[model samples]
Target: MNLKFLYFVIFMLCLGQNLRAQYVEKEEEEKITTLYPEAVFDSIQAKKALALGKGKITGVAFTKTAPLAPRIYADNMKIMLFPVTPYFEAWYKLRNSKENLRKRRYVYMSDAAFRYRLEAISNSVGKFTFPDMKPGKYFLTGNMSWSSTGSYNEHTGTSYGSYGTQADHYEKRYYTQNHEERLEKFVEVKTDGEIVEVKLK
Candidate 1:
């Protein structure tokens, strides 16, 4: 019976090795992002780290069409929080600042990459909270868009009469265009119980 038990133990060890090999192959086949070719997805690490600490993130999401435009609150808007892993670090570098982000508006990540994220919705006043977060660096993102319509007066040439030239005049011109505001920020939680407040505009 001792010899039989030894053979069973060896078979189980071989089976475990086979399972580990399959898992590694599966991870190798996963899709990757071209923005940061050196980045490898680490969903397990992100999730584990995200669940280890006790923290919270509170912020308000607001935006404007232009410098002189009115402040628009992101009412009932969605907010995404991602751990600053390698994949997200690459993404953040691509649009690190407002100027860089505005210039490269089409940069995107791979859809199939492993992503560990949390979500929340802003209230009517654009206030949102992500509680029970771990101590680490994170990325906060929100988007607001709408179409604005307005009218203005423009000076045109003199109107022509039936047989003679008429007087000069101004015409009312209407304009409408789509406007989008993207808010991206990085926040850190230093302790287990900390709150990071941000104005996510």
Candidate 2:
């Protein structure tokens, strides 16, 4: 083989490998993360919502992953109430979409933006409350998460007998899934003494 022709073939092969690697990396990134808008965390707005006032907020967090599956509760789970600032609002818009949320990556938030929020734990029935909340708009979030084993019966083959008699063979199979219910809601306190009722599911 001519030396120049052999060297040219090797260079083309290396270029092809580089392009393949870049394509794979881009695909993985698309599946893993998405760029989101940046917004400054507003301390004043968050502080107002965290203050004590006459307004009250109550809610329950529950989720039914499937029609046939059992309903799961956020029992003993920590819940948060945050002011609907620009940062959280952006996260909500992206997370609330079913197309974007289904078995996909979760939107990331700055630690500072996530900090300084009210928290409460849900009861056995997934009920929670935040008392003396300042009259303002806020976001209530929680997790109603659990996992369970699923199963199905599969037929391997049929066993034939004399006189047209036959028998069926079957086997049981099982699988497990993680049911992550990251729930959120928007609540507005209209009055100092008003009570806001909500279902966080």
Clashes of 1: 0
TM-score of each: 0.65, 0.68
lDDT of 2 by residue, 89-113 (tens): 8877776668767758577667776
User: How does model 1 score by TM-score?
Assistant: 0.65
Q: lDDT value for candidate 2?
A: 0.81
For candidate 2, the per-residue lDDT at 150 reads 93
- For candidate 1, the per-residue lDDT at 196 reads 85
Q: Rate the local accuracy (lDDT) of all candidates.
A: 0.78, 0.81
Model 1 misses residue 125 by how many Å? 2.3
The segments of candidate 1 whose C-alpha lies over 4 angstroms from its true place after superposition are 1-36, 65-69, 94-114, 154-165
